[model samples]
Target chain A: MIDEIIGLYNYWVVIFLMMTGFYVVIASTNLVKKIIGLNIFQTSVFILYITMGKVADGTAPILEEGITSYSNPLPHVLILTAIVVGVATTAVGLALVVRIKEAYDTIEEDEIHDQDDSL
Target chain B: MDNLAVIQVLLPLLSAPLCLLFNKARLAWMIAVVVSWAALFVSLSLLVMVNDNGPIIYEQGGWPAPIGIVYHVDILTAFVLLIVTSIAAVVMPYAGKSVEKEIPVSKQPAFFSALLLCMAGLLGIVSTGDAFNVFVFLEISSLATYALLSQGKDRRSLTSTFQYLIMGTIGGTFILIGIGLIYMKTGTLNMADLADRLPAVFDSRTVHASFAFLTVGICLKLALFPLHLWLPNAYTYAPSVVTIFVAATSTKVAVYMLLRFSFTVFGVDLVFAKLPLTEVLLPLAIVGILVGSLAAIKQSNIKRMLAYSSVAQIGYMILGISFVSASGLTGGILHLFNHAIIKAALFMALGAVAYQIGSTHIDALKGLAKKMPWTFAGFAIGGLSIIGVPLTAGFVSKWYLVLAAIEKEWWIVVAVLLVGSLLAVIYIWRVVEVAYFQTADDESDIQVKEAPLQLLIPLWILVIANIYFGINTSLTVESASSAATMLLGANS
Candidate 1:
C-alpha cells in the first residue's frame, strides 16, 4: 500500500500541474500568463519523464571518480533535450507576446479578439 | 558514402546559426537562398539515389542502431524531402522582399535564421530513424513556428500564438509520453528496431496505450478535423510568408510522420486490425471534408477561407487512406504532394496580394484580376486545381480517390468527394467573380499593377508544375502508388 501510494503520487502531481496549466491558459486574459501556463504544462511533462527514469537508490549516470549504480540515463538525456526545447519554446512564446502587446496595447485575449472584430 | 546521408539534414542545421552571425540583410538572403537551394539539390540527389538503390541508413557518430542515434532515408523520406526542400527553394526568394517589408529590418536576420532552422528541424524530424530525435526536431520546428506566427501585426497574433503554444505543448507532451511508453516496452528508440521488436509485445496493454497516445497526439499535431481548432487562426493571423511556409509544409510534415508511425513503426496490422482506427478516422475525415468546405464558404477573409479549405483537403488525403487499398494509398500520397503545391501556390498568390494591398479581405481583391493579372491568373489556376478540374493536379488526386472508392463499392464516399469539389467551385468562383467581374472600388486603384517579376516567377512556376504534373504524372503516380503499396503491405 505504501509503494502504491508512492507510485501514484508522481502521476497525481503530473495531473495536477497539467490541469492547473491548462486552466490558466483557458482562464487567463493576459498573453504572458498564457505563456506561463504553457511553461507549467511543459514542465509537468518533464517531471513525468524524470519520474519514469527514477530507479530505487540509483545514482546519476556519470563516469566520475566513483559511481557504480546509475538511474536510466536515456530518459534523463531525452528530458534534457526536452528542457532545451522547452526553453526555446518559452523564449519564442514570450517574443510573440511582446509583439502582441506592441500591436494591440493589451495582452488580454478577449481584447485582441474584440479589436480584430472591429477591424 | 553511407555517412554522407547525415549531411542531408546537418548542412542546413549548421547554416541556421551562421545566419544569426551575419548582420547584413543581403548577405543573409544570399546565404539563406543558397542553403535552401543546396537542400533542394540534396533532396533531388537523395531521391535519385533512393530510386537507383534502396533505403540508406546512417548510424550517428560511428555507432550502431539500438545503441546509438540513427538516420534513415527510405523512399518515403526522400519523397517528403523533395516536397519540403523544393517549396523552401521557391519561398526563399519571395521571402527576400516579403520579409523585408513585413518583419522589421533589425529582426530580419534572426527571422531568416529561424526560418532556416525551422526547415532543418522539419527535415531532421522526417529523416531521423530515432524516435526521441523525432520529438526533439518536432519541438525545434514548433518553437520556430511560434516565432514565425507571432510576426503578424496584430496583438491577436500573440493570443493565437499562445493558443498554439498551449495546444502544441500538450500535443508534444502527449507525443513524448507515447515515445517513452514505447521505449519502456521495447527498450529501443531506433525505429527499425522498434518495428522488429513490437510484434513480440503487440498484445501488451502498455503498447496499445502507447499507440493510442501517439495516434491522438499526432492527429492533434496534424490538425485532423476534430483536433484542428488551432490551425485556422494560426494560419489566418500569421505573417503572409509564415502562412505560406506553415500552411504548405508544417502540418504536411506532421501527416508524413503519422504515416511513418502508422505504416512503418507500428505496422499496418497493428494499427488497422486491432484498433478501430479506420472507422474512427474515416468518419472524422468525412466530417472534416464537408464541414471544412462549409466553414470556408462562410469566411469573408480569403486567407481564412483558404485555411479552412486546407482542413477539407487534409480530410481528402485522410479519406484516401481509409479505403486501405493500393489505389487508396496512392490517392492519399498523391494528394499530399498535390495539396502541398496547390496550397503553396494559392498562399503565395495571396502573399503577393498582401504585399501590394496590405490586406487579404475578399472585398479588397475586387478587380485584382484586371489590376494584378498574373497573380490572379495563378490564383485562378490554383482554384481550378482545388476544384479538381480535369488536367490539373487536384483532379489527378481526386480521380484516384474516387477510383479507390468505386473499387471498394463505397459510392457514398465518391459522392461526398464530388460534392466537396462542387463546394470548392462555389468558393473559388466567389474569388473569381470578385477578381474578374467586380468593378474596382477606386478607379485610381486600377493603375495598381501586377506583382513584381520576382513573385510572379515562383507563382507561375508552381502553376505550370501543377499543369505539367497533372498531365504527365509518371513520376508522381509511380512514387505515390509504390509508397501506397508499401504502406498497405507493411507487416502483411
Candidate 2:
C-alpha cells in the first residue's frame, strides 16, 4: 500500500494542484488573478505530461555513448509547445486586461459586470 | 499533386503578413479577398481530388508519420474546408466597405491580418490529421478571434472578450489534457495511429477519462448547451463583420472536431454502443434547442437573437448525432454546411442594417422593408431558411433528421424537431413583422437606403445559395452521406 501510494505521488500532486488552480480561477473575482489561476491550471497539465514522459533510471534522450535507457522526449516537446501556447494566452489575457482597465477603469469581474449591467 | 493540402493551410498564413505590410485598407482588403478566394479554389480542387482519388495522405517535410506531421485529405476534410473557406471568401470582399466604416484607418491592416490568421488557423485545424496539431491550430484561431472581437467599438466588448478568453483557455487546456492522456496510452499523436492503438486500451480508466475530457472541452468550444454562456455576449458586442465570420466558421469547426474525435479517432462503438454519450447528448440537445429558441424570441437586439438561434441550430446538429445512424449523421453533417451559409447570410444582412442605422436593435429595423428593401428581402429569405421552410437548404437537413428519428421510432425527438422549427418561425417572424409592418416613425427623417453593393452582393449570394441548395440537394446529400458512412465504417 505504501509502495503504491509513493509510486503514484506525481499524479496525486497533479490532481491536487489542478483542482486548486481550477478553484482559484472559478472563485476569484479579479481579472488578473483569474489569469494567474488559469496559468496555474495550465501548468499542472505540463507536469502531467512531463510525468508521463519520465522513466525510472532514465537519462535525457540524446545519443552520446552506451546509455541503454532514455526518457521519452515527445511529451516534452509537446509540453514545450503547450507552454508557448500558455504564454501566448497569458499575454493576450494581460493585453486585454490592460485595455479593459483603460475602458472601464476597473479590473474586478464584479465591477465590470455591474458596469455592463448598468449600461 | 504539387502538395495542395499543405498549400491550402500555408496560403492564409503567408498572406496574413502581406496584409500588414500593405498598410492601406483597400490594398489589405484586396490581399485578403484574393488569398481567401484562392483558398476556396484550393478547396474546390481538393474536393474534386478527394471525390475521385479517395483519401490522400501527405507527409509534412516528406518525413513519414510517427516522425513528421501528416495531413489526411478525405471527403470530411474537404467538406469542412469548403464551408470554412467559402464563407471566408464571401466575407472578405464584404469586409472592405464594412471595415472601412467601422474600423479606424490605422487598424484596418492589423484587422485583415488577424482575420487571415484566423482563417489559416481554422484551415490548419481541419486539414491536419495530427491530434496535437489540432490544439495548436485551435489556439491560433482563438487568440486571433479574441483580438478580432476586442476590436468592437463598444467598451462592453472588452469585458466580453475577457470572459471568452477565460472560458476558451479552459476549454483548450481540457483538450490538451485529454490528448496528453491518450498519448500516454498510445505513445503516438497521429490520429490514425491513436485510433488503431486505442481499442486495445478501451477498458482503461485513463482512456475513459480522456474521452470525457475531450467531450467536455469540445462542447465548450462548440458552445454546446449549458456550456454556451460566452457565446451571446461575444457575438452581441463583436463588430458586425467579425460576428459574420466567427459565427459562421469557428463553432462549425469545433463541431467537426467533435465528429473527428468521437467517430474517426475513438470509433463509433466506443462513443455510442459502449458508452452512454447519446444519453447525455440527446437531452442536452433537446433542452438546448427549446431554450435557445425561447431565448432568441426575447432578445431586442437582432444580432443577439441570431446568436441565440445559432445555439439552437447547434442543438439540431447534436440531435442528429444522438440518433447514431448514418442517415442521422448525414443530417447532422449537412446542417454543418447549411447552417454556415444560413447564419452567414442572416448576419450579413444584419451587418448591412447596422451599417445603415448603426444599431441592430429591433427599433432600428422599423420600416426597413421599404427603404432597404434588398437587405430586408435577404433577411426574409435567410429567415425562411432558418425556419426550415421547404425549398430552402435548412429543409433538406431537417427532412433527413425527421426521417432518422422515425427510423429509430424516436417519436419524441421527431416532435421536438418540428416544434423547434416552429419556434424558429416565431422568432424569425418577430423580426419580419418589425422590419415590414412597423414604420420608422414618420416624423424622423432617416433615409435608410439599401446597403452598399459590396454588402448586398454577398448577402444575396448566400440567400440565393439557400434556395439553390434546397432545390438541388445532390452535393450536400452525397458528401454528407458518404462522410457519415466513412465515419461509421471505421467501427466495423
Candidate 3:
C-alpha cells in the first residue's frame, strides 16, 4: 500500500490540481477568474504529460558518450506545443475579458447578465 | 510526389497572414475569395484522385508515417474536405457585401483574416493523421471562432463568446488529456499506429478512461443535446457572415473528429462491442432530435431557431453512428455532407435576411416574403430540405437513416426518426408562416428590399446544389457508402 502511494504520487497531484482548476472554473463568477481557472486546468494537463515523460534517475534527453539513461522526450515536446496553444487561449480569453469589461462595465458574470437582462 | 493534400490545407493557412498584411478590407476580402476558390479546386481534385485511387497518404516534410505527421486522405477525408472547402468557397464570396454592411471599415480586415485562420484550422484538423495534431488544430480553429463570434454588434455577443470560450477550451483540454492517456499506453501519437496498438490493450482502464474523455469532450464541441447549451446563443449572436461560415462547418468538423476517433482510430469493435456506447450514445441522439426540433419551434428568433435545428441535425448523424452497421454509418456520413450543404444554404438565406431587414426575429419577418421574395424563396426551399421533403437533399439522408434503423429492426428508432421529421415541419412552417402569411403592422411600412446580388448569387448557388445533389444521389451516396464500408471493414 505504501509502495503504491509513493509510486503514483504524480497522478495524485494531477488529480488534485485538475479538480481544483475545474472547481474554480465552475464556481467562479468573475470572467477573468474563470480564465485563470482554465489556465490552472490546462497546467495540470501539462504536468500530466511531463509526468509521463519522466524516468527514475534519467537525465535530460541529450546525446552523450557516457549517459545510458534518458527521459522520453516526445511527451515533453508535445507539451511544448500544448503550452503554446494554452498561451494562445489565455491571451484570447484575457483580451475578451478586457473587451467585456469595456462593453459591460463589469467582469462579473452576474453583473453582465443582469445588464443584458435589463436591455 | 503529389502535393494536393497538403496544398488543400496550406492555401488558407498561408493566406491568413497575408490577409493581415493589408489594411484595406477589400484587399483582404479579395485574397480570401481567391484562396478559398483555390482551396475548392484543390479539394475537388483530391476527391477525384481519392475516387480513382484507394487512399493517398502524404507524409509531411517527406517524413514517413508513425514518426512524422502524415495526411491520410481516403474516401472519408475527401468527402469532409469537399464539404468544408465548398462551403468556404461559397461563403467567402458572400462575405464581400455582408461584411461591408455589418462591420466598420477598420475591423473588417481582421474579421476576414480570422475567418481564413478558422478555415485553415478546420482543414488542418481534417487532414492530419496524428492525434496530438488534432488538438492543436482544434484550438487554432476555436480561438479564431471566439474572435469571429464576438464580432456581433450586440454587446451580448461578448458574453456568449466568453461562454463559448470557456466551454470550447475545456473541451479541447479534455481531448488533450485523452490523447495524453492514450499516448502513455501506446507511446505513439499517430492515429494509424494507435489503432494498430489499441486492440492489444483493449481491457486497460486507461484506454476506457481515454475513450470517455474524448467522447464527452467531442460531444461538447459537437453540441450534442445536453452539451448543446453553448451553440444556440453563439450562433445567434455572431455576425451574419460569421454565422453562415461557422454554423455550416465547425460542428461538421467536430462530427468528423468523433467519426475519426471512434471508427478509424478506436475501430467499431472497441466503440460498440467493447464499450457501452450504444445505450448512452443512442438515447442522447434521439433526445437531441426530438428536443432540438421542439426547442427550435419555441424560438422567436430565426437564427436561434435554426441553431436549435442544427443541434437536431447533429443528432441524426450521431444516431446513424450509434447503429454500428454499414448502412447506419453511411447514413451518418451522408447526413454530415448533406447537412453542411443544407444548413449552409439555410444559414446563408438567413444571412441575406439579416443583411436587409437588420434582424431575424419572427415578428420582424412579418411579410418579409413579399419584400424579399428571392431570399424568402431560398429559405422556404432550404426549409423544405430541413423537413426531409421528397426531392430535397434532406430526404435522401432521412431515407437512409430510417432504412438503417429498420434493418436493425430497431422499430423505436425508426419511429423517432419519423417523429423528428414531423417536428421539423412544424418549426420550419412557423418561419414560412411569419414570412409569407403575416403582414407587418399597418404603420410600420416594411421598406426592406431584396438582399444584394452578391448574397443572392451564393445563396442560390447552395440552394441549387442542395436540389441538384438531392436528385443526383450517385455522387454523395456512392462516396458516403464507400467511406462507410471502409470504416466498418473487417469488424465482423
Candidate 4:
C-alpha cells in the first residue's frame, strides 16, 4: 500500500503540474509569462518521464557486476532529449519575446493584438 | 535501392549543417537547392520502388521490428515523402528571392538552414517506424519552424511564434505521454509491435486515455478547426517562404500521423467502433469545414484567407477518414498531395505578388493582372484548383470524396462538400476581382512587374503540376489507393 501510495503520489504531482502549467498559459496574457508557463508545462512532462525511469529496489540503468536489477533507461534517455528540446524552445521563445518587445514596445498579448488591430 | 532509403533522409539532414558553414547567401542557396533536388529524386525513386514492391520494411542498423529501430517505407510513407520533397524542391528557388527581400542578408544562411532542417524533420517523421523517433523528428522540425517564423519582420510574428511554441509543446507533451502510456503497457515502441500489442490492451483505461490524448494532440498540431487558432496568425505573419513551406506540408504531415495512429496503431475498429471517433470527427469536420470557409470569406489578407481555407481543407481530409471506406480514405490521402500542390502554388503566387508589391492585403492588388500577368494567371489557376473546378487537381479529390459520400448515402456531406467549394469560389473570386478589375488608388505608385524568373520558375512549376496531375492522376490515385489500404491496415 505504501509503495502504491508513492506510485500514485508521483502521478498526482505530474498531473497537478501539467494542469497548473496549462492554466497559467491560458490565463496569463503576458507573452513572457506564457513562455514561463510553457516551461513549467514542459518541465512537468520531464518529471513524468523521469518518474517512469524508476524501478522498485533497482539501481541506475547502467549495468554493473553484482547488480541484480536496474531501472529502465529508455525513458531517462528520452527525457534528456526532451529537456534539450525544452531548452531550445525556451531560448527561441525568449528570443522571439525580445524581438516582440523591440518591435511593438510591449510583450503583453492583449496590447500587441490591439496594436495590430489599429494597424 | 533499399540502402538509398536511409541516405535520402540523411542527405538533407547532413546538408542543413553543411549549409550553416557557408557565409555567402547565394552559395548557401545553391547548396540548399541542389540538396533538396537530390532529396526529391531519392524520394521519387523510393516512391516508385514502393509502388512496385508494396511496402519496404527497412530495419535501421540491420535490426528487425519488435526489437530494433525500423523505417517502414510503405505506400503511404512514400506518398507523403513525395509531397514533402516536391514542396522542398519547388520552394528553394522561390526562397532565394523571397528570403532576400523579406529577411536581411546576414540571416539568410540560418533561414535556409532552418528550412532544410524542417524538411529533414518532416521526412524523418514520415519514414521512421519507432514511435519515440516520431517525437524526436517532430521536435527537430518544430524547433526549426519556430525560428523560421520568428524571422518575419512583422511584430506579431514573434507573438505568433510564441503562441505556436506553447501549443506545440503542449501537443508534443501529450503525444509523449500517450507514447509513454503505450510503452508502459506493451514494452515496445515499434509501430507494428504496438499494433499487435494494443488490441490486447485496448480495453484498459490507460491505453484508451493514451489513444485519446494522442489523437487530440496530433489533431491540434494538424490545426483541426477549433484547435486551429494558432494557425491563421502563424501563416499570415510568417515570412513568405516559411508560410509557403508550412501551409504546404506541415499540417498534412500531422494529418498523416493522425491517420497513422488511428488506423495503424489503434486499429480502425477500436478507434471508430469503440471510441466513436468517426462520429465525433464527422460532425466536427463538418463544423470545421463550414467555420473555416466562412471565416476565410471575411479575412482581408490573402494569406490569412488561404490559411483559413487550409483549416477547411483539413476538415475535408478528416471528413474523408470519417467515412471509413477505401475510396474515402483514398480521397483524403490523395488530397494530402493535391492540396499541397494547390496551396504551395497559391502561396508562391502570393509571395511573388508580395515580392514585387509591398503587401498581400486584397485591397492593395488593384489592376495587378495588367501589371503582372503571369503571377495573376498563376493565381487564377490556383484559384480554380482550390475551388474544385474541372481540369485541376482539387476536382479529382472532391470527385473521389463525393463518390465515397454518395456510395455511403451521405447526401448531406456531399452537399456540404459542394457548399465548401462554392465558398472557396467566393474567396478566390474576391481576390481575382481585386487583382484584375479594380482600378489603382493613387498611393500605388510602385512599379508593378512580373516576378523574377527565379520566383516564377518555382511558382509555375507547382501551377503546372496542379493541372498536369489533375489530368494524369494514375500515379497519385494508385499510390493513394495503396496508402488508404495500408492506413486501413491489412484487414479493413
Residues forming the 10-long window of minimal summed lDDT in candidate 4 chain B = B483-492
What is the TM-score of chain A, computed separately for every candidate? 0.85, 0.93, 0.93, 0.90
Model 4 regions lying over 4 Å from their true place? A1-7, A65-67
Docking class of 1: medium
lDDT of 2 by residue, A1-119 (tens): 99777999999888988998999999999999999999999999999999999988999999879898999998999999999999999999999999999998999988888888922
DockQ, each predicted model: 0.58, 0.75, 0.72, 0.65
TM-score of chain A of 4: 0.90
Runs in model 2 deviating more than 4 A are none
Best by lDDT: 2
Per-residue lDDT of B439 in model 3? 85
Listed for each candidate, the true contacts retained, as a fraction, are 0.75, 0.78, 0.80, 0.75
At residue B99, candidate 4 shows an lDDT of 84
lDDT of 3 by residue, B1-492 (tens): 358988988888898888888668899999999999999999888889999987889999889999999988888999998889999999999999998778898998888899999999999899889999999999989999999999998888888898999999999999999999999999999999999999998799999999999999999999998999899999998898888889889999999999899998898988889899889889999999999999999999989999999999999999999998889989999998889888999898999988887888888888889889999999989998988988999999999999999999999999999999999999999989988999887636756888999999999998998898889999999999998999888333
Question: Interface RMSD of candidate 1?
Answer: 2.5
The models' CA-based lDDT, in order, is 0.86, 0.93, 0.91, 0.89
* Stretch of 10 with least lDDT, candidate 1 chain B: B153-162
Chain B TM-scores across candidates: 0.98, 0.99, 0.99, 0.98
For B276-376, candidate 2 gives per-residue lDDT tens digits of 99999999999999999999999999999999999999999999888889999999999999999999999999999989889999987887888899999
lDDT ranking from best candidate downward: 2, 3, 4, 1
**Residue-level error in angstroms, candidate 4, position B109:** 0.5
